[model samples]
Target: MTHPFPPLVEAYLADLDRALEGADPRERSETLAAVREHTREALALRGSDDDAVRHLLEELGPVDSIAAAAAAGTPAPTPASGPPLADTLLVVLSVVSLVLFIVPLFAVGTVVWAGTRLRAGAGDRSRQKTALVIGVVALVAFLAVLVSHYVATA
Candidate 1:
């Protein structure tokens, strides 16, 4: 029988499901349902499952981008903000950072600077904020070492 419908629909769904496999249960479920719906309707209308699948897959392109989009739907926080609270940890790191050759101080300074920028809400500049935080921490530690070393030697 001639495929009254396009095959791309099924292809699109298959790609979507494949991409969704590694996704969270909630996301997988949602995507599964949505993709199924789209495919079912398309195939039913065309009366050709295989053709519909192929056509859909061809038009939808790769599944990676779709997976990325799905993931982006709920963005993850930056590494700096994630975890055991860098704000407090940074102060400690600053001290540790200074113990060795003042390099750590520079790191501390960068971290602090980044944190400040973040607080100011740079909008799309969150990455900059993170870098600034690290930089502040490093810089502060470096300064601490410099001051200590100079005073100790002099």
Candidate 2:
């Protein structure tokens, strides 16, 4: 008798998945990926009746079942990698760069510029940090002296 569930494609995928359960790690990976691709293709040609799903299932077999089976047998796959460098560090430098003046603005500015470039090029965070520190300190020292001189006179 023709099976009642018109979602034959889904049934076939389930069976395929079951079969893959008994497969080796490498075999399971390839089989599951292939079945997933077939599933995509089947979805694209989707029909209103269950017949299309059945037909696709007949053509593809039980992929989800195969996947379930494979899952039962083996370990999970690896995930994707993440990016380096943090947003916080970048923000810190930006904030610090603004509160500077006094140390021959040009010289301090150049250090900040070169330090920023160095950090970007070499992936060395310390370079920019050091530059920022030097600029701020020199500027503060100069300002302190000027303030002292003015205060003593007045």
Tell me each candidate's RMSD, in Å, in order: 16.3, 17.1
> lDDT score, residue 82, model 2?
27
Residue lDDT tens for model 1, 11-124: 555666788777887877775665555545444433354654565455445667667756666532211222224444444454444444255644656466546645644322
What's the lDDT for all of these models? 0.53, 0.52
Give the residue spans of candidate 1 off by over 4 A: 1-15, 74-154
Write down the lDDT that model 1 would get. Answer: 0.53
Q: List residue ranges in candidate 2 displaced over 4 A.
A: 1-11, 61-154
Cα deviation at 19, candidate 2, in Å, is 1.3
